[model samples]
Target: MDSISFQQYICNLDPTSLPRVVKICSGVYFQGSVYEILGSECCLSTGDLMKIVDVQLQKVTCENMENGHMFDLPQDFKGLFQPIPETPGGTQKKPFSLNPFSTQSKTAEFCGRLYSLQEVLRSAAVRQKRLSCLEIGRSEFQLYPVYKVKAIMHFRNGVVKIDSTLDVEVVDVTEESRDVYFIKPLMLSEVLLSDHRLPVEAEILEAPELPIAFQSDWVSCLSKGCRVHIHSKGSSRQILASSQQGKKGACHYFLLSSSYKGTFRRCPRKFSSTTELALSLGPARKLQVVVTKDHNSSEEMPLFTVGDRLRVLSLARADNPSGMDMLVCCRDNGEEEEEEEQVRLPLFLEAGFVEDLRDNKKYTLSEVVQELQLPCEVKVVPKDAADPLGSVSILRLEAQIKEHCLLVSLANEPSLAFEIPPKWMDVPLFFTEGSEKPSPPTSCSKVEELSEAFYYHLLKLLPSNVPPPPRPPKRRDSKLNNCPEKPGERKTSAAEISKPPFRESKSQESAKTGARQDSLRYPNQYTIQYGPQRPPKPTKPCFQVTGTSASDDSDHDYEELCEEVQKTVHKLQRASIKH
Candidate 1:
């Protein structure tokens, strides 16, 4: 076994070099033996193996060998750097990071571009304005000296605010590529929601972390490595049920399945069933029950009629009833104003009473959600019951309307076919092949929500890149902690200090930020960040009024501070007019 220290192993790897599996030699040598795999926390035991898929430079603690000063920078710092030249002595190569900033190994960035230390030293601008400005001109001069010369490293495991870089260990990012993820296997819910493409045949890669305790045919589908098809996007509408007999008795005899065969009548609207008559014409919205046949237990009973309409008035102050164990139906004659004339039905009567419904118009799927109660009879209507490509009775809707779902079934098997609910034990498979390539939905989610195991598995099948987040902002309190590394070489005037930092794309402006004016307000490309939504923060002012006055912020140069603004403006105006 080729064993190496954790740092050595990481330093020797890059995006293209991974995913290499490495075993822990000892728990004590690692940073806290506990590991949080893709947000699911678990312990990493000694001798246990983990794959290092990619490396990110979260922060680089750069130590200026010449000045012996140190500071930390995020992996996306945009300042230029030039490698410290050899002491007029030897030769050794170095490394560089290509993310956010594309600085080369050992050699630094200057004048918004990479330059050798000798090249920087040879510039006439560097010799005259070295102490005041970093805006090294190709030929023309600009203001501001290099404020930062540190490296930033980002690692995949740490997920959060881009401005914070990443909360990962300080690692040399050059050893790793700027791309890749450290993820885990798919969750059952993710697999279910993945039917982005309808009718995708899915093979479960892992068993769910939470077991489905309820026993059903679907329970068998939850096993690892089992293949299932993701058919449709489930409906979010609710299906309410009231079982007067019990849970078992209330469920209709028809099973909701693809292979089921059944016939269903349209809900009646005209002189329909007994219950329909009562509700439509009753004074209290009571359901009217019609006597199906004529019979009497007593001789004193009135002459039995084959078609008798008896009004069951007060199902009571009760408005809507569902899933009840018992029903009390009280009836009243239209002419009888007396309570004594009211007839109440026995709860345990052995007689069979059937449900009656009035005809409703042909309902669209959307109409059903807005208008009717489910478990009320419906046709299992397939959108395309006979497509040679196979019937697509269901549509996988990932659009805006996912709030509440209505159960859908085939019109052919209104009883046998059903719509899949948005959540709960739904059609086992969803999403499209559960593609590992991060879609808009998955990529927008916080990194903690991703499954590392599943991500890698998907990568092997269909490889793609996860969009990198915008660089994190510098820490606010960083100024309190870090001081200038080369104070003597980087003195600035009050005029320069008042010049606000430009809001332009730092990466894009790496070479031309010196030309940016304080008034420039370029809109950055909108990038999504993790965490809750917040109102847009206001733009930074040219200068804030702080308690500590800036009498002499940087070393004072009276001649430079008092330089004629008009002279520079005249030069610019003349140059523009000539051009």
Candidate 2:
């Protein structure tokens, strides 16, 4: 039996100096409790670092410090454990967290999840059994120990309190605690005010004019972990009625119509969808318009301005039996399906239609003709054949033309027409009586004959001869003349070769060969004849002496004497010339 405090036991036991067979001692005192010393200390407190010294049948010997004493411990005892320094504030470490998400232990959470000692041991035992089975016959079976344990409760506030002998607490909140959302003209994020259900209350911090597509549909909102969908704006009355009808504190929302139904509690965190721009044409037609605006619009509400022209399928006022105002409408997007959809405005917006033209005035068919200054009975061509790549088709329709452009009513769609250019019209359209069989127009033959004649005339205009290929440029004089003339041809003399080529190869070769033969035949002859020696004698006098000693002290004072000598010599020479 032993009785010792956890602190004293830890202080006396050296965990790091554990040996294969640890020397366990029976202790009589441990925090005023008497207990028999077992193998190893299995139950470990938080911030108490220890090591397993030895293992026996269902028992272990453990030491707390590298130089401390060892104590026998049972194998079943388990608790949270971590290293605590031996200095002041040694017990500052908190207990290991079972949350699995928090960074509480080094080796325990190495798998990126929290693991308890008991669970770890259990998993190890399971793995050992699985491995034994695999060694026998179940080789295909694999063992994957699960490290994350499901938590009974999750607190988003990130503060956890624990009660035990250690009384540990964990607080982990790294990022800002507030939630942020963005609302744009294209899309918006809303928050749910209640639980999961349809017709729930939601709040858009600052609501903007929503797109027309959002009309008559349910929208989902998520707040924290709860989700809700709503059919209409949450009014106080509807919210009250919903609360009364359903759970008291359930999802709060206003129901636009009891007929509405939706199956979304918590929608995904993000929802992205494009909104189409629509313009109301008349009482019936809605046209899609391509919107060109900044991705991040500055205005709270996106709106169309004046002087914008939207393109749409061609329409004429005459075609409309009601004779309503007509305007060309275009959509901002080019999606194929969207082209067919019309814009629907809310009831409050009295101006249901948005004018596509810069000027507010609407023109009738007659007015359009007058404005364009078009003449009646103009050729009309197919729209497809208007471009250069488009081949002219045989079919032709002529209604009225203006500035080489024609507008002909479409047969299938009377309300719409094809705007054609003059070039698109196939030449020489022939109209035959209904009774007579249709055939190629006779004018086509004439056109062919005329084209042939024009082509032949163009050919005649071109010059008959290409003016013989320009003679190749004459070769310029170059060093190719370095090669001697042909064997039989008159050979150039040394004068010619040396004068032009500078050093003649023939002369250089002869001099080199002769010098080489002389050196080889008389190896030491030249050296001996021109040995390293001074000349035997000088043919000319060293100086014009005029009777002076070879070594004279007067040399130092010769400048004065030399001057007088020069004067007398000059006088003698002048006299001699006179004589």
Candidate 3:
């Protein structure tokens, strides 16, 4: 019989109830334990019993058995697979070697021929018992083998919800094993849910259009031509905006939310705001007057004396009473808008003779008033009235009369004004009535002659110690020109006839004595010498003495006489001298 048939038979019979002698393909083996029975059929030792079936199954499959065949089992098969050494008597057994055929060369040879008919049966049965599991669709739950239906159904209702209970065996044909199992379903849900129904395609309604109501309040008013509009509420009270023109005026309108406002007001004429008043009234024009001296007419004359009373009248009032009143009162006319009025009093000259007259031709009335030292008030009594009227009336009446007002009435006419003529009353004068007359001035000719004679006499009386006047060189022909020559007389050279040696010697001696005396008196003291002492010698003697005087022994006396002679010669000398 074939190995498949034998394996079928062995599988049909239960191992526990098997008879002692069993017929396999090759021989009948005595059955003891399951291991012994399997080992004996495979021709292997009991030690390798579990693997014997596997080795035999491989051999049978590889041969693709045609019919029952006889095979030789190698000798020493028992020695080939010696019993694996036991672990410590009570400990768990060690895992057997996976290469059951390579247990030993002897065991391999012997078991190599035996067929694995029982292994094929056992594998086929195990395979048949395996259940498969598959993942189907979106739910992600797994389908178990049909054998685990009860457990799966229980898990669906949550009765049997153990994590590991679906341990059904599954055979994977692709991998040749029964290994994996499937788990029950896991479900997920959304975090939050609402009961209200949601709309799918409702039309969006436009909000009702709001009417823009512009609000404004009067914060402040702007004058004409203002570009800024004031707002009632904002950070700043005013703001700038586009200009708006209306029948009333031009103005600006601003939004309420603006923060800035204009504060400056425009001037009508910014550049010409300030104007300058008149700076110049032109150069001042001076007043002119003519003054003359007076000599006759005592009553008409200016009666002046020291400490005499005097008064003055303004001639500006001579034309009319109003004029006279204006002059007397000295009221200012307020005609100019920007100019101030200057008040002034009329002037008068006191009763006094002329002390002095200034030669000023361009003297003004004001200057005359100042020069005359005139009083402001003068009492005048009409010839009819004895009592004195006020000064003002007197001045007014005097201005009307148009006649010269008497400045003073003195006991006597002052001598200072005696030279003034009576006709020149208009000519003002300052005088001294009681002042003494000044002495007369001497004649110029008489003074000159007196001075000349006095100086001549002084020169004559001067001491002999006085220095002599310097002399110039004489010409060679001077003597010849002045005197006539005798027929036999020889003309002497000017150098030979210059001076007598004796006289020069005496003059030198006198000079030496005077110098010695000066040195003796001053003695070793330092004296400053300033100019040249001596002049160059003259070409000729300047003088020719006509007569000799006695007492010539003393050198000083000779020097004195020589000086006198030199003076006389100077007097007679020609006027023309080279300066």
Candidate 4:
């Protein structure tokens, strides 16, 4: 292609059209600098002037014409991404108003977002009583808080760029209540447009959205105790702690959620810088004063003291009331809930039974012991437990008792008594101090000497009249004889034994005749009688039989006789047969 067509092709070619073009080629300058284009290569060299000597199908090589050195380049090179130039309004010579109400916005692309040009200009505007200028190299230019947006530039590679204002604010130099000025507020100056080092979305690296005023629970500096709320250039969930203090004596700190844990640094140039995180400076607190004029009016004096706390009626009214109004009852309602739940439980007012720890038995209280029993549920408090006083939780069984609550220290030789509230009885009690129960008296005399008195008293509640049920003696190394180990010798061997003839015994013959006579005389009517009896021993081998008959035989002995006769005949037949 001719030079004209080649230039046209380069202009029409979109670098970002190819998603594979991720790495960016270096040597492209943001300032006015010329780049060399060879036959098939585009040489990008960082210098005032560079001369291209060779070109390849996929590679571009160039030598620094100023230094006269051969250039070594890599393949798959891409053009650099530069920031778009300012819009027409930025280049105009007209002075813009500092008033915020006069701000206007024109639709334009900023940080890849479609923003109004006038809105960005207004954001970049800073109001100050005195003018400030910035020095870059040898050139000096007046600074403005905000600048007008001129245009949006779209590169062939899908990268977009725009000129936006950097946000700044003024803050107090000291914690004192006097109006003092140490430095001028940050002012907006020239527009900064630069190419990113890598191929990345410009919008992604832009500063976060910032609130107008920074808020916090409380921010404390490590070096000083002064608490200050810092605003953000852009809203970010990152808390910034400066290693170095600002021009003013105050250290800049911003509030962020507890979730964020990262380092924060201010960006020196454009707020869109990728390496630097953009943040807003805190605003100065202004107090309105009513100046009284003298006859000359040369010097006006304010009536209010500088140190007085300034409160906005709107804010004061909103916050003057204590936060306690927003709080629910801080006192625990657990006691009320406990009372309701305890109502379902049964009262233990009946004759009390003492659990014998030694025997692991419970015995009923005898009348003698019951007569002396106090109307209280006594629980033994073990030693070395949570209760230092070694007190037991006692609930009075008798409502008539003046002292409904009592404490008997288990640790003492003589149990001591501490009075607790009767309300404690409505719930499962713990000996914690407070509420109706105060801390147990520190001194021993403060408590009654009921110590082991109640312990023994409770032991007295056990029935001394009723004897304990007897238990069988434990057999040592005793096991039931399941089977005999010895084998008995047979009376006769198989060859010597003779087989007996099958014959019915006289008892069986008589039983058959009786059954036949009974069946003929009367129909059988069986009546079953059953009752509980002690289990039989292993050796006794007792069993039961039940049946229905139309006979009048109710005698237990007659039934046993019938069963015995049947067994005898079966045994005889078995003995007659050969083994």
Candidate 5:
């Protein structure tokens, strides 16, 4: 070696001593130490000491030695440690020597190669690889990248699929739109936070905080990445059983829907069923008496009165009992018996039971009698008779025979029955013209005519019942005289004419006196006057005083003179009469 420097020799050393001799390489200083190493700022000896052997050095220069291997050297010593030829004719380069002084470099190089090999083996083992069936559990399984699973479906066995591919068919698709339910999903992480199994308790936190979303499919993944799947073969049949049990309990109250049952509870039976039966009991049975006439002979009979007993026997068959067959005894007194003959009579028949008659149907008297069972013989008693005044004739047994012949005739022919009796019907009487005096009965053909007149007079006696006729003129003669001014005209003042003096001729006065005397003699006779005449003047008498002195009686005489003066003045008024 041609003067090999210690720094050059150290630069050719390997990095196996890097761990133990890095401090020594830093402390040593050699020539050409100012040249920079590629990775570190330490001298060339320090870089060589830190270098790894199996990790090929980058951006480094090398020198040659007698061996065939190349030795790493400092980039600044490129000209000095050039490779030496092995032989003159041979093309082999000589390898650099291992310096005895660079023991730390070789040791550093060996430890670096061992650390790099360990890092490479660790990276190779971590690469992704597909798992075999043995690596997974004893069951067949799928490995999803990123640990993300969408849904799961469990079969009848304990086996499950990650995403099931079965198609669902519905019997009636229209029911899906008509009946729908709202579904909500929950995640495993959210369930852990709440730690509450009850639905009411979980509602305290809002549904959005539960990390769920709505989906139309049967299988879905919840918001927190939890898988939710519908397993058709699983043991979820308990839900249907609970729903059916709830419906069975609700069927016991079916009586609430019936309309007929509701009405029966609200209404009474009497108002609903038998209303016509209650209205049929109207008037009761009694005795009645009346006068009769022969239909063929047209003859009248005497009046019947009270205390008479009438037997009303039904002519009905024995098998049917239409009404009760009873005898009625009359109890009217003498005055009532007299009234019975005078009063208008009513047609009487045996009363029948109403139940036998159909509604709105007419039945004959014989038919009704046949329905009610009664004795063939009936008795009718007059009020004045001793033996209970009853009928003994066979005519009374007939069902349709008239109770009273006159009454039945009157009911049929009212015009004939109202005929006036001879004495009681009419009589002549007098009445004043304007007075409210009752008029005596006048002759009329019928009793009804007289009764009408009696009612008219009775109406007049009651002031409130009758209106008054117009008043007659006061002066009858003045009306005949054709005077322009009416007689008895109202005077302006009473003082103007203190007395109404009459002006009559001597002959007229004498005739009037004679008529007055005649009216006094016969009070029943009425006097009649013909024409107009003035009223008579009142007379005053002349008195004489006897055996009195003429001078002493002079004042009395003066009063007589004044009286005579008044007479003279009135006498003048009589002479001025226009008539």
Candidate 6:
């Protein structure tokens, strides 16, 4: 392993062949100064070893042929992805020009089967005419490998689908993989490579004393030869974390292991706009977008006013009348009942729109499968108003609502996603667009990294973590229960034993209270007021309790009514006595 310059080392390095460790040789200098980019040391530290996990192809600088201006296109910028052609024109083989034609394909597809060129020539009654279309006889046309290849071409007119035979160059869309050149995003990753991370398992050869806390036994365990898996997210040269080998949790911050030598995986970057997400996912359906702030009407911007709502319907269309890539959006009709108007604006719209907030209507995750479409814009809202989703705005659920669990990611940040069970974390959401049925989310990403704060929030809300409510103190036993002098002797009479010591209340006389208690003992003998009684409440539907809503709040009203009735009875008695 000869030490080479970082730029030279990764010059020809393929992104597919990543996770390579390159030890910083002596001090790599940038004009006698340390090279730092994005808070990451650019391999300038002396003796610092780093893992080049992955490199994401973000923007490709391409010189425009029309104006010679440098423009950048994102890696997933709907550039090109087509299938292989029947005949591949190798570089050595020249294509046909005006009045001049190249050799047709050697093989011909006939009756759903492939035939040799010689067999087709022999069967079709070969002719020597240089006609663009091959014809044997009248009403008989065999496959001449002519310009019958279907192609989709764009020009002043809208999209035109036809075979490339009308004196036109055979524009095969299948050559994007080989013909198109992709500029490498950075010195680390390759173009159009599947996601690959270097999850390395390394043993701590030498441990730094300051990284791990002294209070925990983990500090002692961070000794030489201690096996630990390094969770180095992203290709940052600085040490991120280390944990017990084979375990994903109970991690400790570890910097400069004794002899750590392993490559690192770069964390996926976050996407900021709905258009970017829609472009990544071809033919995205139900992508719901919410306007976070009001945008004033301007000539450059779409006709978006303060209160108007916008719904992105499709990806940026290059076939606009203005020739610019315009994002296709549906503008909600303001107060007036008008049909949704189509709006086309620049793809890189600088409007204040927050992703993930769907329609204003709120729905729990339980209703997702039955009620919502996939990839809808939404914000995770607490069932109670007091609890808030701090720093968390609207969330985009770009994936499917699972059978038991669902993942919701930040609308603005697509890379960071968290999974929560529908049971405990079934959050309600209002659509950001202020519509009835909300569109889906913009991001095509599934679950990614779960936020540590959100994880702790869920854990705290778990039934095991929450303590039960305190039970009311048990009623104290009465100390005034009378007992016979001699338990073994004759028992007291029933009347004496049954009698309870009575005290006159300040509001009532002793004789009257005793008589009232005696009358209460014989409920039938108690005097009944035969005064005018209010009629029983009507058994109307409004009075009837339906569904699960509680009617217990009305108990106070019932108590007040009872008090009013008692007051009337007492006033009547007083008036009769005075009279």
True-vs-predicted CA distance for residue 328, candidate 6, Å:
0.7
How much lDDT does each candidate structure score?
A: 0.34, 0.26, 0.23, 0.24, 0.24, 0.35
> Model 3, which residues run further than 4 Å from truth?
1-507, 510-512, 515-579
lDDT of 1 at 199: 40
Worst 10 residues of 3 by lDDT: 272-281
TM-score of each: 0.30, 0.13, 0.09, 0.12, 0.10, 0.20
Kindly indicate the candidate among 2 and 5 with the higher TM-score.
2
When superposed on Cα atoms, how far off is each prediction in RMSD? Answer: 33.6, 39.5, 58.2, 39.0, 52.0, 35.3
Instruction: Report the CA-based lDDT of candidate 4 relative to the real structure.
Output: 0.24
Residue 470 miss distance in model 3 (angstroms):
19
| Candidate 3, RMSD to the unseen true structure | 58.2
lDDT of 4 by residue, 1-579 (tens): 111112112212222322111111122322333332222222222221111112112322333323444443333323221123345566422223323254444323222332232232223221111111121122212212211111111111212211111111111111231232111111001001122121111111111122212221110111122211111011112111121132454332222122222212111111121001101111232211111221111121112221221111111011111111010011112354542211110111111111112222222222212322322232223334443224322222211112222222222222222222222111111111121312233322221222233324433544453223223222322121222233674433343244466689999999999888654432222111111223533643222222322244444554564465556656767877945
Pick the winner on lDDT between candidates 2 and 3: 2
lDDT of 1 by residue, 1-579 (tens): 334434433333334544444444553435445444334443444544344444554444444334545555444445454333334455433322213333343322333455433333333233222221133322222211122111111212222212112112333232343342334334435544544444444444445444232223334445555654433454332222111233343221111222123222334233332223323332323354545554443331233244544544433221222111122343334345656344433122233233344454565544544454332445444334442112212221111122222222221222322232334333332223334432121111000111334323323443222334434333344232244345354444344444689586877786466335311321221222322335655743232222333455442232233344434545667877999
Residue-level lDDT of model 5, residues 1-579, one tens digit each, is 232323322334333432112111233344325322222232232322211112222223221222323334332321211111123364322324343452222222322222121121122111111111222123222111111111111111111111111111111121222322212333323333334421121111112221111111211211222211110111110000000113333211000111111110001011110111112112342222221221111112123322232222211111212111112222234464363222111111111211211133322223324432221222222233332112221111211211110000111122221111111222111111232322222221110111233333433443351223213223323211342433765423232355567689999999999888644432222111211324644533333222233344534664565456557556767766744
Q: How close is candidate 2 to the true structure, as a TM-score?
A: 0.13
Better by TM-score, candidate 4 or 2: 2
> Against the correct fold, how does model 6 do in TM-score?
0.20
The better-scoring model by TM-score among 5 and 6 is 6
Angstrom error at residue 142, model 4: 40
